[model samples]
Target: MLSFTRGSFSDRLFFHHHSHLRALLQYRSTQRSLSVVGLLPLSIVMSGTRSINDMLMQAARSKKGAVAAGRPPASHIAVEKGKTEKKKEQKVSAPHEKMKESGERESGRKDKSPSTLEKSAVAKINEPCEKDNGTAVQNGIEAPMEIDSTREDKENGTIEEQKDSDMGLEEAKLPDSPDIPKISEKISLPPVGVSEVPSITECVSNLTKRQLEFDPKAAAFWKKGEHVPFAFLAHAFDMISCESGRIAMTDILTNVFRTIIFTTPEDLLPTVYLTANKVAPPHHGVELGIGDATIIKTIGETFGKSDAQVKSQLKALGDLGLVAKACRVNQRLMRKPLALTCAKVLKTFKEIAKETGKNSQENRRNKIKSLLVAAMDCEPLFIVRLAQGNLRIGLAEQTVLVALAHAAVLTEKPPVAAAQLPGRLEQAAQIIKQVYSNLPDFDQIVPALLRVGIQDLSEVCHFTPGVPVGPMLAKATKSISDILDKFQDIEFTCEYKYDGERAQVHYMDNGSVEIYSRNAECTTGKFPDVAGAMTRYKKDDVKSFVLDCEIVAYDREADHILPFQILSTRARKGVTLSSIKVQVCVFAFDLLYLNGKELLQEPLRVRREYLYQSFVEVPKEFSFAKAITSTDLEEIQAFLQDAVNHSCEGLIIKTLDKEATYEPAKRSNNWLKLKKDYMDSVGDSFDLVPIGAFHGRGKRTGVYGAFLLACYDEDTEEYQSICKIGTGFSEAVLEERSASLRANVIPTPKVQGRKCCGCFVSFLFL
Candidate 1:
């Protein structure tokens, strides 16, 4: 009798079926052969059967014990391990499995199918491991089996979806393991078929094509005291340029500012100036001094292109920044360059500005090339535009101030609540705007804001005696009647609107004087004679003061003021008191600061009194503006006539008391100018020709918005730029003019005697 104790069904079946054959062969063979063949088969079967039976019995006992204890048997554990291995394998191959399957199908292998074993394996792989409990015997151990439906799905080529699902599950569980590195931190591996590493240029091109995404966790990744990469600002500029709405631009800038504030507080000042397209405060007279020629040449040398090629690209693209970006995509650097930082760019700009004297152009080119070589993605675009001193993005100065204010408030310690943030931002923005108007210097305001907070920013950054303040502006009225109507029942004063450069004269207690233009540029070097004359005319008691005056070209012997065109002829730099050819008179109007005290908050009447008491006037050299305090329409008209006869533009009417505080950088209703051009009659007309046209924006799109007019100088046989005319044109007229000038537009301004206007008037007609 054969005892089938402790054997799996398959093992017992194999032994029983072969037992019959072994017995027959043993009976048919001779005694010797029977002993060798029949005994060999019998012995082998018995021995294997004995060992498998023992192992099966042991496994059966364990399964019984585990069932009683609510635990899986050993085979179920193996199945779990197999599933895990399969999942990992699937992850490694999931990216290419579909391609392999499709390739196999295309090669006339549609009839090919997976073996039964492979189908079973795939079925086991698809089953959910967490719900697996049923066990079936395999060899001698009990293993879990999968449903038939999964096997059928695999046969139908639906296993790709299962592979994807498994991969997603693995990724989901990754965060639970702290030792596992993140996907981004993992080293990138080459694709399956790729044999060679990508070139640097190819890598950069791929990176450039990828859209830039702003990461909210940027601040967390940056180490403390690390200089902010210039790429951050460049990215912000790219976003700002694409957005036409003010609010959207402000949001982008605010995020950038907030990041800079959190990561590198010291870089905030330079970053702000760069965003404003300035290298330093206007009073410092620091400029990039980089011209288009230098930029074109630098790009050519750096990228192995000719100047003509660069210019052709520039003309086609209409932006040198874009041209640089296009050229940079194909250029390869000798070695990996160090990443550019905000502070580094600003310092390089100052260095470029200092590149003067012999071989200065070459030095500037070298410095610019270093930056371009290090630039990646949109960096070259912004760097070129920065060197050009015009970002061309529609970012306004006030928008920058708003962004800065919001950033400071948001990044303040003991962070603000979400509900109160908008209100706080608005309040802080107003405070910043107020303080900046009083002192329009980021060098002073940004540091103060960061140190003392926006609450005390005004106290820390008030109007200093030496620092230039943005001059107050006036709104133009159509006629004297309009000015009288606006200032009805309000005491007002009329002063001659002198046709000269608006100069802010500052006299320091150290016996040194400085002159600044209305835009806050230091003109001390350009008007040394005016600086000397301020000392000669100041009162003995006045030690330091900031006087808002106009510097007009004057004829001292004839005691007459010359036209403003004559004033513009003087040398702009490297001027000495003795080298002055065009003499100018300082017509002081409003006193802004006196002896270290700010007079901006005082009424115009009080400021005028201070002005008159603080300075002594000399004829044709230094004097107060010709003024008359009156509201009579006839008297104002007569005064206007007198101003016109004196070569003044018109009359400026200012309020005496109510709402008359000096509002810096504002075209306020408190002051109005009655210009001769605003009158009904054509007071003056120029016989000039249009040399070039500027591209329009906003509603003036697709047409020339303005024309550069030049007057012929008979003595020099040259075309002198007189003015830019953008007004008094209807849509029909603009389109007509644009059509007429389109044919005459030349690739370059090749006229021999044309003066450079330093503007974006590229479509030259002459």
Candidate 2:
């Protein structure tokens, strides 16, 4: 037997060869009984197998048994050997102090004679031991050896080897082998007190409970300023889309707005516009102009697919948004894209809108592709839909306003109980809706709301001269009797409802005239003649005014008002005074603003008086709507007939006195439209075919809600889209019709002579 003390050269050599000795033992034990392998002991195995042939024989025999005995397998042994060689090379190449420190750390345990240590280790290995739980225990060490053995068993082979090794080690009663010193214990101090870091749940809870504090000076989430990720808005849209209840959608939007108000107040305007599926105010006339083909092409390019493949996927998915989401699954990028911010997205959309003239389509495609490439998660779903000019998430402009109102109130830190919160929210929502009705410009309203709070929002934003107010609507009346019965004893005026487009003409203080449609779309370019005619008709004293009127196609020589179909024939854009083929006459009715003063709060009678005094009639160029102030049924019926005779659609009976203030964006009960069509049965009917449908929302969810009806043109051999019908069907009828139409559904519209009308239909019939 060889004996040496710790730190001796021989002892160091023994320690270095320890892993090899174990490998030899593993081989011997597998080929024969443990008693036979233990006969030679660790010293003779280490000393005897010095030659190349002897070592090769030992390694070959040990290969199977080494793996079977829960030792490091051949591959693991090779890796370990490589690691050991690298460590040796580093130690040899290192500075003298580093080598010395490593040597001390490896051998720093209390010194013991090599013979004594060998005896102790041999005694521990030879003794039979009970299992500690399911693990084999050969020494004091528990976890590391057991874990390595279990891992090797899984990696190298099956559990049979592990079971045999565990049982063999437990049953074997071998003679003493040389001892191996235990690995040094790494001293890990217990963490000082509880961890200082808060959990994700705790952080979220804190944010929810924390009162909102608006700090204009505080650093924003984005580099430029306070801006939210576009993903945040997409997630909200996703949640709102999945939800069918209007109240639930409102709640989700409310929370989304709250987060934006707290973290990035500057992004609130863009967020609001995106939520409403708009890039700018309606009167701005900004449109994305991205077609389905362009969107499909952009998606295909981003995901490395053909347009046909994208179209195929779109057919399967019905929605381009879904197609985008599905295609993104396998998408790879050259580098990680910059995170999209709300302001960045709005800016991109505005850029897309500005793209026009030669190569405009290609430019738009590239911009859209960039957006798709940067989009992550459900963001692609919304980006596609937003480009299509519809979100289809059941989030109405009214609902967004309601949510915005509530979010603003909550951010103000209302000093009220939970019971009072709902009332406060409702009051704030009403105020916002009212202000938005009068102003209808988020660019003006949102900043004002955040500045003066919801209480004074109206004072800050109301009836601006350049911005068009939402036109007040009227409820349809069945007959003159219904109007008479509803307005019993209330002073009213009956005016001719001309068969023409509703126009709101704004004469600016700079002597510039602008015209807006009922939906607030700019039509100044479409009707240059009408704008010129308005200037000629206006009195010299009328400096700046907003006139609510009807622009009708009129015959100058015959002195007759043409039908609405004739007015629709005029060019919608780029029309010059010289190219005025379809001449229009403006019949001014009510004055909303005059000489920089808002008359919205004034009675209809007073506003009407202002309208008549401000502008004079110019025959076919401009005039006032013929009106009669009477309570008699016979007189009203005669006037309605006269209106019909003059190519008017019906009569607009409006309250002239009490409760008659102009209510923009409202379908007021104070005004009623007695159309000639409502007084009789179906006078005209067309055999229209259902070619396409719009997906249902709200109560009509999960079924077709509206349909695109088209009439066949025999001469063109095509189906010409006539109109879209949504109101006549009941719930049961819609489902029944949807079932029948669903079977005929095609992936895309293939009808000939169907012009690009910018209508997004959910499903198309063959």
Candidate 3:
């Protein structure tokens, strides 16, 4: 490797800012009207100037002309330029170095030697300078005057000064900012420690060399098919990583090649994590119609330059919707990002290969491959990662276990973690991991999770009763501390939070647990456990009854909450006990039907009195989530704390007056979520680590645009991009991060990725 440390090239036809113009001239000279050389037309070159610079320039011009004609450059052009640039670095210095020869020649001239004139001509270099006399002179710049009494010395000095000065004018120029600063100057990047890499060049270079070496003949197929999508994804990846365009492109080829091949070539459908950028209500009407170009312009101005050239690039990004279309985009929203992992990517590709027959090129050619709409088939490994958002050999499973720990208040008992419940999605992933460690990739994981909880049964429900829940859960709270002190005598009631469908489980004693979802639609077959559990309930007054409770995953052996995952066990029917070990536990928390009345108008206190006075209480398997009511603020605070510790979403404070009527199916003001976490934090607080980021969209693109944060992998060192977070940032965060993150630009590209030993993200397809 030729490393450039310190040196100077001799007199050579180095390219100036006028290089393209010079090349244009060379192109014009070529009778071909297309050759590009240093200011000479191909006609001139063909007639022929045999200099190497002229030849290279001519070739460059020819290539440029071809591109203008809308043709791709032949591979030969890149190879040719590579060689030319290498050679130019080694060019000889100006002939002015022979100043000593100049004097010798002059003496020879005095001696009337024949070689005198030729030698003097060779020593003469092209240079001119005015001698403080303020006049343009054709002779070289004069050296500082030195008075020499010695006659021979004075004569030799004069000749040498003239020549050497001329040579000084021809030395090669130096590069800009040679000693590249570390990305994180404040924190040194140790060999293995997460270091700030100011730029992505070195890694990108290695990637480029690898690509050049990747199956040369398949170049046509891959090149024509890959470039644009690869380019865009790489660009997005770079923005997220804070790397430059070239570096992003380089990383794409190196790290992300396999994922790209397996994903949609045009839209890159595999990467589902990059939500289309849009202005959120983070700050309502902060500004309008502002674009990244504006931010770039401002940055340019700050740098004492203009963004005229960069505006178009920013425009291209906007057109692609990689940035918001709004005029004044909120800096916080624009900076929120999503990140993916390498392992997920590998699993996605492997699944695609398997589904399409790994080596069956002929089959793939025959198939009109469209796009990957759904994630790759769920692999065991994939499931483990999908839940944890990270995939190390043992890492993903650890996440679910932690979620279990949180739900069980394991963190509070000994570790005192802020969060507990492994939420629904995390609960599912944890289940998969708990059951299997060497989980399959995403392609294998997604489907199984979908089968259990995903209900496309839109045929039954209308509105999305519960929020989309986003990609992951924020936090759930039921704290009633604030409202408890207002009431003199709070009522404490325990009703079974039934596990079966809550949508008015209407059974006319017809030997059926005809249940609907939270939304009313008779889904009788979905939960056989709920049906079986209800049959065992000692309800002599339940000839025909309706109740409300959650459908839970139960383990008959433990008769306890199965880490919120026991729900998955009862998904499909006709199962032998050993097959899935599916069981059900019913927690009937309320009742809307008894005898022959619809109690929708009944007050919570009345219903509680009826439930407590009417039903029996059992522990573990079938009972309430457990609750206590109080008028004291301390008691309410205790409830909130205990609920949070119990993996519950804070506390649910409810009015208990007998006159307080039930507001069926409404998130009314009568009940409020006094969440412990939300009371102190903004938006929802998630323990996510930054995995990817983006340049700020419109307006705020100057500083760090946005960031991609993911849940941490306790076992595997990875972050799976789940949802693109775009809210709840304080100004101080942006101000501090703006300076710090510039150092840690991902050396690997996000679009594709460089080779990674662990799991990569496959969420681009989610």
Candidate 4:
């Protein structure tokens, strides 16, 4: 037997102790003329009587509420015990019917004075009256009523009996206070010097007007402190779905953030994360682990659609989210749905994450099905997209964060003027971006900004020992000449760009090391040997530090570094020192932190000096990236070739200026990736703007077989035909490109007579 009991009423309704009594007492206190102590018993009795009558009315209306009286509880043990136990008591009294009979009590007191009648009414409060046989009377009115269990009403247990079991309870209705004057009650305005008090009608009219002013969709969930429907977010997602311009996308994102700010300010973080198309912060690793199979199964279970039917919809729509939306709109529901809240959705995702081991797959399938069933139209669409991690809504995390900063300022009390807003908004965005670059968690940042302004958030955000910070990015340049042009007169240090994985290694004070990828994912388990190497070669003076470096596979016997492919062989999990084949060397370059101090704000030159002085590099296990400091192009050219000879990619030309501070998660000209691929004369590699492509057949079917390259026509601000190259690309590259084109390419007019080697060339705009 399944227990469907949803806990107790006190757990579901009242959040605090004696809440009903407190509410009643508080209401009576507002009227001063009423005796709160005397009204306590009267209030409870009235509340109980009203509840019994309401349940009886509901039972009379629907047979769904009916439950067998002699069913003998659910389980075998309870059945045996129930046969020996005493029969439960039952009594019924209708307050309205009892009030009509009050004339008898009043007639009996007709000869008595008004004070005597009042006393008589108070005296009969606890005594049982003879009327209706078992009905108890309180103050000439019906007291607490136990529901009758007579044969006619025996088909079902009363409301109180169902409270201990499965039947859903209706909301407890409180009786209206008799003290507050009704709209029909006479009232007179006070004389001179008295303040005006609103009448009951005026108060009710104002409340209705306020409700009318609120957004209907938001107001539905606002009273319960739940998230607005996903339909609202889907509308925003639709607005920016096809938009290409940055400004236009930013405008739409800002509008969405403003809506969240105004409607559910506390939900801002979860909303931001969902809109960013992630379940949690990048560093935290909260994957939904929901595969396409899981999504299909959930949709099938939810709508009773077969796998083939779902597949047909998916193939036609080309998006799982759209498939879900279509299925949801087309299918009829089995039962009333539970409302989908942003918080509820997030919590469900967390629950899914916790389902593990043997039965985990079935557990996940059921949970996801519940979520899909509870969600409607656009809600299931977003939920499916979120699970798939393919929210194709053009806005990125940066855009969302910028909009959040703007929201914080715009939604502040005593609104900021329009003219003064731009500058403050920019400052707020920069502050938020800076904090996010270090922390990168909206769960932490959003609440801090909401609690204390941006100023405090900036000060509060810091680099923790284990959590990964976004790696600093470098701008790309074609030549040393172009790089010099950007950093004119400033001497720059050119470091060899090793063809290896970029790793950020944190050496903690507790003698533990954690390594993270450039994307801030913890890859600590994948590089246990690297951790051992760091411990062996770590500087004694450096109690704790963060090293930004490259980890390349080392050919120990040959005394040379292997390519990235060799290092890629390392396992992502369950790595052991004994089974390790490919040995790696850490090429330390920039020191972002040293000895409990963050050097991100310090000059690159200063950080490099600390890096060189603090740690001694081991030969094949660890070493600093070879560097040459010079402003001369010829010297840099020679160094770049030497790097290429050593299986390196190219040179990373970094500014040697005092203000060349490390900017995380940013691409700045201060640090440039001077790669051979960008060189125009190299011929081996050419960066051509792709403006069109020709569809393939036979071996290259269903994809754009070859791309039509172009050069910028500055005067016309358009692309001109250059050359098409299709031979070099692999099947994987062609398929990836084809998928990208199919998703992002806009339709354009065909070239009537033009062909690239007997193939039709289809042009794209962006």
Best by lDDT: 1
Q: Rank all candidate structures by their TM-score, best first, as comma-separated numbers.
A: 2, 1, 4, 3
Model 4, position 589: C-alpha lDDT score: 95
TM-score, per-candidate, Cα-based: 0.65, 0.67, 0.29, 0.64
TM-score, model 2 to reference: 0.67
**Steric overlap count per candidate:** 0, 0, 98, 0
What is every candidate's alpha-carbon RMSD to the true fold? Answer: 19.4, 16.4, 25.5, 15.9
List lDDT for all candidates, in order.
Answer: 0.69, 0.68, 0.35, 0.63
Is 2 or 3 the stronger prediction by lDDT?
Answer: 2
| Candidate no. 4 TM-score | 0.64
Model 4 lDDT per residue over 260-361, tens place: 666677877777877888778877767778888778877887788898888777756766788888887876432335567676777778788778899998
Q: Which residue segments of model 1 deviate by more than 4 Å? A: 1-221, 333-335, 682-766
Q: At residue 304, what lDDT does model 1 achieve?
A: 92
Residue range 1-766, candidate 1, lDDT tens digits: 1111111111121222222222222222321211212111111122222232232233334422121122222321000000111122111112233433433333343333322122222222122222233322222332222222222242332221122121111221112233332232331222323323332233222212211233323422345578878876787688677777778777778777776777689999999989998888788888777877789999999889999999899877867899999998866432346779989999999899988899999999999998998898899999999999878787888899998998888777897787887788889999999998888889889999889998788888888777887888887778877877898889999999999999998888898988899888888999988887777788888889988999999999898999998999898888987777899888989999888888999999999999988888888788899999987788888888999999998988899999999998888889888877779665434569988889989999999999998896643434667788999999998998999899777776645345556665566774
| Per-residue lDDT of candidate 2, residues 630-671 (tens digit) | 988899999989989999988998999898999997889998
Which model, 1 or 4, shows the larger TM-score?
1
Error of 3 at 329 (Å): 36
Question: Which segments of candidate 3 are over 4 A away from where they belong?
Answer: 1-481, 485-504, 519-526, 553-559, 569-582, 617-619, 639-650, 674-763
Q: What ranking emerges by lDDT with the best candidate at the front?
A: 1, 2, 4, 3
Measured with C-alpha atoms, the lDDT of residue 597 in candidate 2 is: 94
